[model samples]
Target: MGTLNLSFQIQTLYMSPSSPSFNTFTISLTTNRKKSNCSRFSLSMGNPNDTHTKLVPGAAGFLLQDVPHFTDYLDHLPIVVHKESARGVHFRRAGPRQKVYFKSDDVNACIVTCGGLCPGLNTVIREIVCGLYHMYGVRKVLGIDGGYRGFYAKNTITLTPKFVDDIHKRGGTILGTSRGGHDSVKIVDRIQDRGINQVYIIGGDGTHKGAAVIFEEIRRRGLKVAVAGIPKTIDNDIPVIDKSFGFDTVVEEAQRAIKAAHVESESMGNGIGLVKLMGRYCGFIAMYATLASRDVDCCLIPESPFYLEGKGGLYEYIGKRLKQNGHMVIVIAEGAGQELLSKSLQSVDQQDASGNKLLQDVGLWISHKIKEHFAKKRMPINLKYIDPTYMIRAIPSIASDNVYCTLLAHGAVHGAMAGYTGFTVGPVNGRHAYIPFNRIIEKQNKVVITDRMWARLLSSTNQPSFLKPRDIAEAKKEKYPANGILDGKIVKTMSMN
Candidate 1:
């Protein structure tokens, strides 16, 4: 018996708006070992809780040398995390021998999809199954039949590599999907009953929230099972991730609808084409689609409110565009224009199983208004309203999405195998990493109207501002007079003025 001595040097580079700081430290370890034995061990940079520690390039590259080099056969591998910080954005990458926390051959893994169907659900599911079977040599993969409910409902189907080999050629999940199954305790009970060690939940924000609860319940029960999710928002509204699965397909599909609308509108005398995209709380789909398809004349999103009837409002803008060019194309998100048309925030007597409010149909509402606005005119106005949400979401994903979904699935599986639970495999700066569930659900991602993307969209479209800057200033003045309001008297005087 002898001893082995290992020494490593760590160099950290801090980047900021002011300057860059470079620091280096050396770490060494010595342990007694048999001369004939090879150590099967792993190296960690620093304490996981130390958010300030930054692992520089040299250290990461050195650590890569010690890991297995099986990634040579893979076409695309995750890049390395060069810099780490807490203040702003961070980059993440994977090493050759990333940790596989669940290393047993009999590990039971369940895959479930929740919420609506997207373009690449089948592709992700198939990749997950194949990765588990071939890479990790795990043969016990189960597909939950109907999302979260399938956990407690005892509806599952055994999945194998052969079963999912050609699934990527199809759309939607073979296991099916639904919403409103947030029974954490019951789901954990089902996991324990089946002896499942890893669960992959594929869905949007709501599904992630449910996953967080399920993870918490597993922890409360003192269980070791891991729960991971792949961000499935077709709207691309998940925060921190550069893009979610199916978003590229969504933008591509939405372009077709926009092209059709443009052709139909340009063919008529005073034509207008209205398109409503799927974005409930965010407008990434509509915004990106408008930018991609340059035929759009006006773009309205939930992040930017529009007026129907005032100076420089939606109605006036459409009328002006018709007079100028004889045709107009307007792209509006499904969640857009709700505040302007609806008197209250209440849903229109419709609720889903998840208890979410069914959004009012903004497309139909705007369509009727356009007709009424031009009804009395002698010159005929032809307005086409298109809602292609289901059609777009049902189709197959493009090449870009296929690659992105594959990477997301791989990242999730790696995280789950490495004992990383309660996190979603999302991208930061176009690299896949395990993003915590709380960060995903803490805040909603929305289009910033002030950003360059929105500015480019507005300039490219050349549409009238639905609500102008001066109008916003005047509204603020009307609410609060120049002279401070002493009481009701000041309000009355301001009204008189």
Candidate 2:
């Protein structure tokens, strides 16, 4: 009995009975370089007795196999109900002693996808579901629809290994997710009723905050439920963890797109191709692709201002590149700045149940601005911008990273069963590892950006700095061409329209 279901939030259909419900969609997400359908899950109905070696990819074409299996640790993996778990007796004394027990048969766990879409969400979902059912002997893994809102909703789906069997390599999640809308009352009621023993959340910065809140609520309820969060998102903004899952895939795909775009841009001679990559608040996607595709002439990010006052910044840079360099390929983040911020801010007035405003589309606005800029400044300097937004976001072409997500998910299951609720299994220092829950639940992980990295990105024409990891700084500056005016003596000037 396969029970496969996707978690795509209801698209303005309002299927849930809740009022003023959060958009329960992507608009509330912090903008990032995005691509593909990015739709977001699956598992077997039951676990097989055979031990299989799942190969998950690490950075730079490395593969991690087997991973560590936690099924043998019966102490951590238990069959329980009502907070009581099944444990074998070791030795008993003649004197009377208190016997403690835990009730299992419960699933008060919450998992979510946050920030932006990443490949392998479905695989992660599968490992989680299978681990709970087969090893822990638990029942019912609730899939929260539309991210944080689903946790508070009249919306959720019951998951099993059978439910997620076919989605190992698919893009997005079977449980739909959103950025905010973590209402305590609604969430508390649901967990209390379902007897959820633990909660696991998957996301980056914006989404993880909600995880912290829900974890706190679990404690306040006097329930023994443990809370855990998995660090997801292509942006990889999460700190403390070695690397958030999905980032490598995003960077890899973005690099391919840039390579393809570069070949096309070079063929056109003197044309400027502006390819938008995924990092909205950050530049991981764009910058990494720029580093990968040295052929790219320029890169832009939200951190660095490319278009100053719309008249002379990015437009001037692109114009100069076309006239002098003969061709250019620029990588930019979707959440990038443009001359069109305030205008769009006035147009959209929708809010989530939490009363937060929706974010605007900076990618489209930037595309329009670039078209208008080149059209007005220089004579039809051929300009093109490829929005790999949904393309990379929803990509299911290959499963190198999906396998890794599954392994991590499997590791998470081991972690959870080890009474290790509240920790996200992740890579540590380039190795497979676990980031405990204390940082996410009990403390605030600071969002830090360094001075040197910022300076290099601003000055370099090659790559955006924010996308690179804090431990490394490899992005180089880009060089732009200055067109020379020819009347009598050749003089450099902004190319006239």
Candidate 3:
């Protein structure tokens, strides 16, 4: 790398003895002026008109320390970049920049939220509105009510900084939310009618899938519109992101459920506390809460399946704990161990509006089982079953979540104005970047059961490995009776003693 010389004029507060009338001093760099790379520069400070003023000794220390460097952008990249085939190497820095593709006065933006309510939803809305208007001079921002249906349903309110300034203090989306209504054609027609050039869709994977469809429809009509998403998976199941907006808040809120369960178990004589968390397909929320609370005795997640009635099963675990400690706390995700309790998905055929199969009631199901087993044994047991899924989802975000939502919104606005579409603002190795919807929804993110986080959680709870290494082999070798439950091999092991 070569060097470049640049000079700076500084207005110093101190007055020089020889030139008391001169308030400004000129600092000139003595280096190769034609070169591009200037890692270090030497400064020569003196009055402009007076050649008699000599350069101060060691004056370049403060001047050189304040100057910007050429390799500053490299620090933004990940510490360790996983090289795939080592072809077409490049660098991409994230954050808002001045250059944009859209004209500030002519730009029209639309904001829509979908799926369930989550913490930091209002904070994200406030930041996007503030960023578009204050940062990009965008004035015609509209907030869509409900989810994808808001596009064609003609439910919108004009968004202004004054209107959204106090929304971050409250929970839920100011524009409201809903599920389903992912009609791409109708939504695109509405977007065109309103002259909306940029659309910010905030929701989970299903909502992002809908946004992708809408973006495709816009392209099919040969229109120049931008569609971006802010991943709002409260369960933290979205792939490629370090953590979703509401995850930290959910972990903080789920701690209350654990606390309550612990208190109830201690109050009763030989009590068992069972708390259920929200995680339809993954168990990030449950796992994080268990790890954070530090009061839980056992935890079950969707990634790791467990038996209900077999040897060394959940019931036996609870019984052993009650005999040992007289009080126990158990945390289970709402989606965990469902196949062992509910009928096959094919046989039940129940689904919500988002086409997701309704999860079986794991919380109540386990409570009943624990009660029945203890009742059969003629043992007096008090088991508290608490489900705080909706309560945690409806609360406002904490300080950390508010900051995260602000950054995600800023990244979304920058990417949209830069003409990037069909992508969501997600973290790439802990730095914010635009990840395409296809890459994000390629496969649902789940907690790695073998990872260090799980190991740490197991050590904290001191629970036996319900899933032994030989359990898979033993499961495959075992035969199933035709009359018993046949959801999977795990269900076959749930035979009653």
Candidate 4:
């Protein structure tokens, strides 16, 4: 991994101390950069100089003095690097700027949460409200009652420090949430009507798309509104960011369910405990929980496909595990084995209000299948199915997530105040950065079956990869279409039989 050394000059506009005029200065710096998909990494609002409207001249005194700020105009964090390209992708480092586009007292902001519920929602909401009030001295903040539709359909509530002081201790959002009521025109109209200069939207992929549209509409009308998104998903599927806000909390909470399943399976002879977790497109939750709880014998996820009734399929693995240990635990992500279920049940694909696919209950279906397979073999097995999808989501965030949510909320507030619109805030490479909405919403982050983490999970469970040579070939082609080369030795162990 060779580092690319680069040098560039950053032109910045700052207020002159001697005169009441903005002066431009150029600073050159040479540093090492990595290669990635840099094409879409730039913010959608275009150049920061063109996107911002000048604040009142004397309002510069309101800038926070104690807090550290990113004085450099070119401060950015590179996204994941790949060997294919030397051009590195980067996101603007998220924090307060020395000079802001909006005045403190003149700013009017609104916060809204859309899409499904997740842990740390209320915490993010609370931090955003409190960050504006205490950090920037912005007093007027309104909470959009529901999701996007609330912009025009529902009433707004005044949010203050006292109002959101203790909301972090609670689960869900105080502003409430919904799915798929996005009307960009109506939403922007309400923001303009209510004098909202800063709009904070919290949700998953769909909500961010809506925010991007709202930002576009606001920009088209030449409004000074800053639409910031805090990516929220229990599945940890949002890309560009290291992970979403509620992911650590969800992974922490999922352990409780896995522990119970382990206890149940260990209690009875030939007991099979099946646990289903939330992961619509990816199996991060299931993979992480299984790794955390070493009791799992097999972990099934959407990325790694598995088939039954074969020589070395899921049925054979389960039988072998039960015969060896007398009891076994299995964890399956909700989206895992969907193709198998559809093939067995001949079901049609359906979507929810937010355009997310409606997933069938994999736990129950797998449990039945295991029982049927064992019964035909004259084997008696007791199966207990557990689904903790909502339970984990409805709980308050853990200690680490609470702190993470605060950082995310504060990052969003700083970006919006600095006139960075159409961007979402999250940590890229362990540093918080403002990511464009298109970058995050363009593709989903999935558990890479060929990655070391997934390999570690498979090694821990002592389960077959359940992947054939064709699966390996497809994964390699999809991930590295340009080179047709995979970094790992996954293809060598593809013999499931």
Q: Would you give me the overall lDDT of model 1?
A: 0.72
Clashes of each: 2, 65, 1, 0
lDDT of 3 by residue, 8-87 (tens): 44332222234432134344444333332222222222334431122322232121101111111111221111122211
Q: How many backbone clashes does candidate 2 have?
A: 65
- TM-scores, all candidates, are 0.80, 0.62, 0.77, 0.82
Computed on alpha carbons, the lDDT of every model, listed in order, comes to: 0.72, 0.53, 0.73, 0.76
Which digits, one per residue and each the tens of the lDDT, describe model 2 over residues 118-209? 77777787878876777667786788788767756677788877888887657777787666566766776787776666677777655556
Off by over 4 Å in 4: 1-84, 480-497
Of 2 and 3, the candidate ranking higher by TM-score: 3
The list of candidate 2 runs beyond 4 A from truth reads 1-116, 151-156, 307-316, 338-378, 397-400, 431-497
Compare the candidates by TM-score and give the number of the best one: 4
Candidate 4: tens digits of C-alpha lDDT, residues 316-430: 9898898888999999988888888888897877888899888888888888889998999999988899998999999899999999999999999988887677888888657
Superposing every Cα of model 1 onto the true structure, what RMSD results? 13.6
**Candidate 4: worst-modelled 10 consecutive residues by lDDT:** 483-492
Per-residue error (Å), model 4, residue 197: 0.7
lDDT of 1 by residue, 1-497 (tens): 55555554544444444676554545444444433212122223233453223332433222221111111111123322312223233333431234455665857899999999899999999888987887788899999998888877766899999898888888788999888967888888888888898899998888988888887777666676778888888788877676888998989999999999999999998999999999987899998999899899999898777777768777778888899999989999998977756673454556788656678888998898778867854557999998998899998888998998888888777766765566787666555555667667766677776567888888999976565787455544532101100000000011110
Task: Kindly indicate the candidate among 2 and 4 with the higher lDDT.
Answer: 4
lDDT of 3 at 202: 93
lDDT for position 470 in model 4: 90
